[model samples]
Target: MTFESPSASGLTRRGMLTGAAAIGAGSVGLATAPAAAAPLTARGYRTRVVLAGTAGGPPPQDGRLGICTVVLVEDRAYLVDLGPGAVTAYARAGLTMEQVQSVFITHLHSDHLAEVYNLFWLNYGAPGARGNISRSVGIYGPGPAGSVPQAPGAPVQQPEAPTPGLTDFLRGAVAATAYDLNTRMAESRKPDIWNVLDPHDIELPDIGASATNRAPDMEPFEVMDDGFVRVTAILVDHPPVFPSFAYRFDTADGSVVVSGDTAPSDNLVRLARGADLLVHEVYDHAYFATINPRLAETFSRTHTASDRVGQLASAAGVGTLALSHLVPAGVRDVPDQVWKRHARKSFGGTVVVGRDGDTIGIGGRTK
Candidate 1:
């Protein structure tokens, strides 16, 4: 699907911020979506899943963005990653930024966090956001990414580092946007962006893992509870990127487990035990069987192979397994049948190669 990215003139951010109808019935960008999309179900389910993004990484693509998924529990929505085009995909899914109550980051890689600022930008800027989206939105995720030297003979640079935690990321994002905030604040009607979010650095257990450290034995910990749902975080292996996480959202009606990004993880399997749906990342090694060893090492190091994803889902007893964040995604032209066949090699459960706007209803709604 062709995405019509928003422009400053098309629908004024100022209009949206002031409660004016920033979008019309078929406004471009946020309103009129592409031809690739299908109609949403006429009857809404109590628990549903929206695959907002299915692309794997930083490389720009036409139809997909980086990994992002929105689990709609009843009427509330919670985000797993704010990848590039996240807000665009949300609007394309017939959802507004205001519906997002909290955001959960698996890890702080730029791919996963690309459009986060937009969330803060539009969520707080929308008219009446103060009263409706009034509460501090919860932002949850892993802590620092630990310092690592450039690969051997690489570029002349110091050890790499990312913000220490979600708190720091939010703080830094806000500070970076100070100019915009200050300018907007001149209007007495603006809501303070600082008060719009409640950032929590998920407390890592002393079993020990920090952004920089590794703790292989990941135990599940209940992190935060928005009135509608309770979220659980567990460590997963995305080595070199320590303290990576997989999250589970448990509501009264159903449950969904999101494997943020990882190699096969026992901790992820444990967390997804008896889940209604498992949204995971997958790469097809067969497509790159003879690629450079270094690139191969990178794939083996950070992502779960397609077959292993099936094994993990089957082991965890999830009712449905949906693969998002497809490495080399649709552009590579590896047919869906190929992916489905690869997954069937290991497990025998319902499997799907997820796409941008694909919606699935859990608690027994099948493909």
Candidate 2:
């Protein structure tokens, strides 16, 4: 998005730092005391996954593929993805976009990255009341892959293309929005409009973007500070869409993993081993089997089926399974009994079908 001129009442670095400090202190109810210094491992961290856009295709419930948008709340806020409805979901979940410190993209799928531009614009142009923060938000994602685009109906193969890699696409998109961002901010009086700090001031990097340098194996890569908790990503196989990832977050009290969008794979099981929770995408096999044949075919080509998800969760010994990125099946389509029958056959642990605003606490502490 485009950038607006700096605010007339531009906040200085010192003022911004002071404001951040105050917010940090107040959030934890330690505003009046000398900063209680503690190692990252000692301080508790929390995570909230918001189902931004449930429906994937056209609006009015065609299908929901609003890929994952997880919020990692620690000393600072880190967002995992920016699905279509993530902005609204964040607000519904009582989170202000302004407080988000960074955004980590899993892939370049439209459903996954559709909200990136909106998020950037919202933070940089919207009024203050809509969760706009001035802090520079970091954006991270995988780099490009060398591949030729196949014609429609051609046999699908490894390394699909036509869509520039995440790095190139984001760079161009952000660069193009510069003018629009500036114009909107200048026209709006809301505090949200002031949230967009200069894009030049923000750090946007394509982590593991290049195929050669990309960590293709299922190993977790630490993304942020390790003081209170450590966050890492593991490569998972989602073929024809190489370089997909599943992320794990470990805190002192507990650990959690976010299985972005992948078919059942051993990579996920290994990554999730010993985690307290696994937030994974699940598709109802029976429901899809009986629905529109075309849609079912598309589903198979892209995501994991429900039974597979159950098996993966079971094998990993995950403590809890929070099913997200649900398919078109509504309550009637996949009744409780059907879900229980399939899920219980594999995962004996607690299995929750996540809703838009559902909150599952990883550690035993209340935030």
Candidate 3:
């Protein structure tokens, strides 16, 4: 028997080009763009969401990327997660790669951060289409505490402590590019990327640390407030992957929440309450069993179930519910129609089945 790679979700470079054309002059993606929202005039900027990559994973497959989203606040693009196909989708969304000033990681999962350095590497070029970002780029994530789990019941044989936190991860990223950083500064007369990277390790407030079932919640707090927009992150449970987060962006236009990757989390519901849009991760509950049961089972515990996502949306009272980070979005049997129905069952509000390259404007309440 032979296997074949799945298609790229009916999206292509040409399609991206066309989609970008619609965004020309800072207009929204399609005619359905909200009316009351502020245009990208010199004074104010509206908030829009671009689901750069939508697949959550064991490893990116079926032409789906890991998980990434770009929140556009006026001219600025704030990226969340750095999944595999993120860069491509960023370009597809008509966003300049170099202008990406901040990247917020929900957690330290490989699939979520695999492509960050790739973006930073390009962001540091010698001033051209290859990213000429002038100011420092800020990288933020949870403070020290191994995101991984410890060996069980081995008091004397406990393993060495896990990587400290985002700060240590930042070190690893620099080390991975040490040769390039040194060679560029020493040989090419180019500025080193380290000079422009500002890494901040955020400590969650016990304020939101909902400590349910023994795992400490990641309590919410404002991580970035650059005047144009304020980004807040709340801790959600995705165990053994302690300190997982879900973010909310309150901009001039409206409020938008990105539910990283979590099971049924009260914190997420609380943060997303009354939000204009809720972009939540959802798996096809019916089809999850069809995939590898071991992985499916583990993911089922950590990832949100489809129907519950709908319930969460309803509970949050978000104007719009957009589902992404699909667990098996590409499984032939689990077409979007089948999966959407799962969420729709409980959600009466607007529901959109997310796709890579999909741009959702965050202007006003939907319902």
Instruction: Find the candidate with the highest TM-score and give its number.
Output: 1
lDDT for each residue of candidate 2 in 120-209, tens digit (9 for 90 to 100) = 665553345544565556566655545543568887544445446665665667577767655654775433322443221112234544
Q: Global CA lDDT of candidate 2, please? A: 0.56
What ranges in model 3 sit over 4 Å off?
1-45, 128-130, 146-148, 152-161, 207-219, 331-333, 364-367
| Residue 85 displacement (Å), model 1 | 1.0
lDDT (Cα) of model 3:
0.69
lDDT of 1 by residue, 314-352 (tens): 899987788888886764556767788888787777776
Q: Write one digit per residue (lDDT tens) for candidate 3, span 175-208.
A: 9788888888788787767777787887766553
* TM-scores of the candidates in the order shown: 0.82, 0.72, 0.81
Model 1 residue pairs with clashes: 144-211, 146-212
Which one wins by TM-score: 2 or 3? 3
lDDT of 2 at 291: 64
